[model samples]
Target: MEDFKFTISKFLKRTALVLVFLLAVLFVFAPSFSLAQVNTGIEFGAYTGLAQTDVRIIIAKIIRVFFGVLGIIAVGFTLYGGYMYMTSEGNEKKLETAKAILKNMAIGLAIILSALAIVQFVLNTLLNEYQAGPTGETTPPIGGETVCADCGFLGSVIESHYPGRGAMGIPRNTKIVITFKYDILAGSLIQDSNNNGQFGDTLGGGNNDRPSAAFKIYPTTGGESAAMAPNQFDVFLSVDKRTFIFKPKVLLGSALQDTNYTVKLTDAVKLADGSSAFGAIGAYSWGFTVSTVADLTPPQIESIIPTPSLDKYARNIMVQINFNEPVDPLSASGFFELASGDPTKNFQNINLAIDEGTKPLISGNFKITNQYRTVEFKTADECGHNPCGQTIYCLPGDKQILATVKSASVDSSNKPQAQITANFYDGVVDMAGNSLNGGGELRINGQNKIVLEPGVKTLNQWQAASGKILDDFSWRFLTSAILDTTAPKLTVITPGSLAEKIDVAAPLNMAFDKPMAIGSFKEIVLKTNKDFNINYTYFGTSYDALGQKVILPTQKAVRTTAEIAHGDFWQKSPTAPADTESAIYYPFAPSLLNDIYQNCFYPAVLQNSPRCVVGDISESNKLNDNTPSCFDLQNTNYEGYCSMGEPCPLVPAPHNP
Candidate 1:
């Protein structure tokens, strides 16, 4: 009995030592396996093999397998003990040894099960935390929030909307228009019983289906609880699927005076691929006040590009007409006529000359932009070179150009006439269905007289009666023989280069030597190295009345927090420049800027040349012998801080030691 007990004790001691060695080895090598999982191409089933990449999942599986093997060993020991006891034939020592073995096996099995449960609980908790974001929301997978082009995932945003946020005095009849940055899923907008990506319903009719709850509208005082029913309003998606127009069954603010309303678009609105349109934001909402009165006034011409006084206008210039108010996009097409001839010619003679092919009416396509308030005419003839590598459209150089905005005449039946002659007609109207008021007195046959109420004659008839059309607007301009080949240059930077102690709330101002295209302002980017919490508000680009100089107040800074520090500050190095010794820094990229003629300031030819660097104000300035002058800092046509015809030196007076 004593020998038997000693043998059992030796076996138990060896088993425990082996188990400890195995556990230590697993822990030591587990980190290497974790690192390999990042780029591993291995594949295996969870039950039968190992396919999981996460280290935690892999460790859990390994531990469970180890415990399962131990349980199988314990069961084998228990069976062996039962067989020995039954075959002992009432021998006390043999039976006692069998009982001891059985008791130890049972304890080992219980411990194995308990350890497995604890490990599983720990792994499950870790996995749940990993899947959830910092805010405990079930967000996209790690690094999946970024907008990707080919991935079909975008940071969905509202580009613009009619009756803008906080807008007051908005016309009651104004339709709610929301333009999105990307195309949306049509089914998400309204009821699509067939599951097809289309609205498939008529406008302003009972047949139209109610839109989904993703879009909502309600009075400001009542909040979303008093939201209007989906059936009360009809939604129409634009042909491109980027814009949605919401038209209420009844006019807004019909009974109330200056009522405030809120419009909300929830994340339930989806992309074509069924992803949330609002992304992580969940919803977008804005409020506007609607006036009791409706918009009844006609849209008028506010300004025209290539003004009548600009005799040296570029031949490749595009004619732009700005309207005082938004007009119907359909009404703007084919109503503008451009011909080269004397401005005083009668409509009949001009039409005759164009019909007989004696005079060339510049053929071009019309594009309505600026929220349907500006019309641009791009001629078919291509000429000149745009430094930005864009195609240039041109008009006949060294010729007198006469531009006319045609007006319609009332027919005998008192209805607006559509087509009177090939080149003579009028259909330009505003969003409120009112005709264009070109700011001129009513005239017939060269006499100031009212022919009929709501039955105004055509511009052609009015021109024949008097020297001018009743409502037709005309302008004359001349084009130069030379095309605009000069690229726009940055003349001034508000905080100035290498400036110090700049206010945190000051606007970043940039002025160009010539007027730049407002649309191209998007290319100018601001970059920083540190993670600073700052909100930049875009104030939009603008030009002076003369249009000679363009001032781009790109952003108004709003400082939300104090400056952040990484480590030690104010390091001095022999190789480091004075510009690098700054507490806060922002770098400007002017290479992307372009002029109205599509000429780039820093063309590819000047990419290797020295360029001006807009540094932060907090940078320390120390005199360096190799420092370049303001002129030397410029690339190609960029003026930097130096004026035209100004002398430049290796070092400026301000930098002299």
Candidate 2:
């Protein structure tokens, strides 16, 4: 029995000694570990995985467990000292040993109590204005002072959150995990000091007045947020009690697949001894995308017109973007960047979070058409310094007709340059709910660059890699300053109006001197002598340049009374207008016609048209009126008063009279 007792005593003494050593080690290493980086301040955690916020919480938990062991050791010391006092039984040396043990314990207890009292008093005095909490817990500082994210209240500390700030593509069925940091507050997020061992029905939620709101997850514009529901999501604590998982009965069934879900950690959830996730740094909130199908594939820029190069491009060039698939329009807006210099080197990965305030260098609106697969941005505007945020306004006769990539590295001529960068960065998602890999980039010579040399002597060029879908297919082009004002003219017409027998089934085809505006051509009317109007329609027009005044049959086709089947059109009855002397052209509005430069059109005589025939006199009379008289003056006398190849001027006038 004595041996067994002595062995037990020895074990106790060793455990106590080891606990003291651990405390010493912790004190020495604390500063380094406590110097934790603030990871929750950002939005992207997938690249870095398993958030750094989790890291800090885990470290805190290990320390808490170690300190808990220390408390057990302290209790052991008190019991051991009592046992020795009972066994001493008036023995001088044994009594002295008992006295020493008791004295040590008393001194330790005194120190612990004094520290607690001083800490409480100082904190209360410093933060006296704050209203006491529901459970007499230490509330946040009274007046809106900055809340410390790392501070503990009473003796407990907990600070962890999820969807990890700006995390994206979170599965709709995944759970919301919040590290509780301690097991004492198991089924709740509040202190349980007075309850001893019993769990409570209600836990305190800080300022929001709703306990379940100590943490919440809601769609950006829907779900319980629109109509409040109590305790819709059930909370579960991990076996170790360091992590809290929130699970909705069903998966997020929000209105759409790309619904935004934000998880907010309110200051209401307190630890067992009473402290919220850093007492008043507002609410710790982070958002993530809720997608039904897991979209791991990234989106890429399929094509961009006026590619990155030193090739000449029109100043009024229409910027077009083609994606592999349709993307959310908002995701692709405000990310198109334009600059005069090499913005290539300074491009940044745009944050897709909606609240990110990064604005485009130029101002413009995006138009999505072609079934939403293409985005068009018109960059034309009035001449002004900084119009559309340009550093210099475009003016006529500028030496560099087009805007060119200019850098301090290049000297002399500021050759024409243009650069276009398109980003669908704000979580642009395809129909499949797959997000564009924000990783897509435009690289120039191992760097993100879209610099164009003025194509003065040679064309400078670059091509983005094709490995990933999100990679940008961006480019630079030399610019042109020329304005187009020449009007489009009809150079030829089929089915000559003077023909004796015109094929009633043949469609009248009019060719233009240039690629005439399709809208302008609609103004051309075919009318009979009876004035019955011929109705015709065309598909949308285009802006391709032209030279030889000949419109392809594909370019212009008239709707004959009997029409032939063609693109976006079918045949009409040839007898509909009733055959007559001719069809006259009257309603062609040149002023409404414009070239690619938005230049207005001017009227010109159509070489010939079935639509109109200008009035004219008899052919012989017209010829005589235009012909010059065949009379000449002779320099020398010749036979019969006329010389070969000389004018018989006097005789001719006398004969005419």
Candidate 3:
């Protein structure tokens, strides 16, 4: 009990001394406050006391004072307990209570000191550093997919770098380039017109009239694995601020022989957000192979004109075999000759010359052969030039015989070039095996006819006879290619006008510009009234298969032209074929009436025919006049009805026709 009391007394003495020192310092250096300043209700002395020190120093002093006061109270209890213990007068219970009080006071002081030590260590190590701003060691933004951490953000921040090609790779031996397409919202990039460094008024928002987009590239292979070469690489690009397409070119200098090179994009070349190089846009990467210097050969003629295979009417022609590459004039001249065919024409007597004075131009003549006889021809060549040249150039020879030298034309370039027009006078065919048909005499007047050879058969008789030689080959050739074999367009309506008045028994159906396909009209309906606003349903077949009949299908209860007319009018009904059937067949103009609808007995079938009619033989009315007659069943014969009155019941239903 005595020891515990002694410890508390010592702590109290130390605290009291510290308090006395603080009070002395305050009294010596503190300033006086004006009465007005003290009007805040705090004592002037307290203000004066606080005024002597800075805020930090004053705060430390305040804490010291609080602890000092606590120490004083603790000391007072301890002394009282000691006094009680000293006066206990041999009573053990009183002595024990004094010891207990002294023990609790000592424990309280120990707890306070321990907490102070912990707080001091934490402030020095953590809080002090936090108060300082970020140093050079601060972490910088790194490459990764980025998204807004805060709420209310709908758009994304993506990098625009393009991958060379296949995911995460590019050819190490070849150069590659990439391009991009973007639809970036311009509103997201430049909202503030006044602020240079800032985006929109709100952070991360901006005007996006033209948003940010870019592309980048770097080495993918060989550059790092082997010794690097100087001046061996260069980046050639066509790029704008928004997009990039670059080709890496390497000068294959002596250091590196022939080898492929490649480049790739890296993390360092990307934007802060690690998005694509194309700025949230589409991109593509492509590569091309490069080759050393080399030469190219000319195209070869696989077969000759007047194709070898003969057409039925094919005749007289001169054809040649071609070479895979340009020929050596001297060697080609000697080697090129018309091979065998009809004995009438031979190369032995024809003039042969080197036709290559003009590099690419070449041709020869077979005029020395029997001019009246047809001949088949072919030619071949011995290779001359070296690089990419052929040792022997040959082509499947095509043939054409000269029936006559009609009008001819040729390319202006320097070469023995000529185009011949002639009939298949002798029915001669060239090498490749195509035949010709007859009735195609040459267009030229004098060359149209040719004398037939002794044994040659004429196309007209399939025998050796000659007349106007035909050029069916050219005609068929043109007809089969450029000229459309499709049916001629029927653009304008037939009969030309729809306003002309005609008999009511039959109506002139409209026509179109093009030939109607077979079987295209099963549901054609004819209408009444000039503009076709009011109508009749003519459920009948088309008379001309090539005529496309337009129909209005839904109306089943429509009235006929006869019913719509105010006066009596009638004409004979005729069976007509529909558009579908017309496609496969053509109709001749009717011989009974004029094509002029207004001057015919039957309006519909009245195209280009003589006008004739059969009605009351006893009546004094003309059938072609406005008083045309209608058939009446009661009469059992053509009689009695007239066009100037009400319509007669003699008109048959359209389906029946």
Clashing pairs in 1: 445-465, 446-465, 446-466
User: Candidates ranked by lDDT, best first?
Assistant: 1, 2, 3
Model 1 scores a C-alpha lDDT of: 0.49
Where does model 1 exceed 4 Å of error? 1-156, 184-213, 229-241, 254-256, 270-275, 309-312, 328-373, 380-385, 396-434, 440-469, 491-510, 522-593, 601-657
In order of appearance, the predictions have TM-scores of: 0.47, 0.25, 0.16
- Please report the TM-score between candidate 3 and the true structure: 0.16
lDDT of 2 by residue, 312-404 (tens): 444544445546654433334322234434422222222111111452333333444332344555442444321111122222221222211
Predictions in order: lDDT:
0.49, 0.36, 0.26
Worst 10 residues of 3 by lDDT: 577-586
lDDT of 1 by residue, 1-657 (tens): 567556655655665565567556655754443232111222112222554354445556676787788778778878988898899999998999899888777766665665566555554443222111131112232222211111111111554566665678877766676656677887777775334445733332244545788888888898899998877765555445665666566667755578999988877988778898766656767678988887655555665555555336778766666667766544464322445353212222111012223455666655454455556676767785443345677877777777666445433342222222222224455554455555442112234222222233454444333322556555566777777776555555555444434443445665555544433443333332222212221222335545422211111111101111111111112233312212233323343444555454531112122333222211232111122223233224443223211222222222110
- Using TM-score as the measure, the top candidate is 1
Worst 10 residues of 2 by lDDT: 403-412
Segments in model 3 whose C-alpha atoms lie over 4 Å from true places: 1-102, 109-159, 163-170, 173-231, 239-241, 250-657
What shift in Å separates residue 614 of candidate 2 from its native position after superposition? Answer: 16
Best by lDDT: 1
Deviating ranges (above 4 Å) for candidate 2: 1-303, 323-327, 333-360, 384-470, 484-596, 599-657
lDDT of 1 at 565: 13
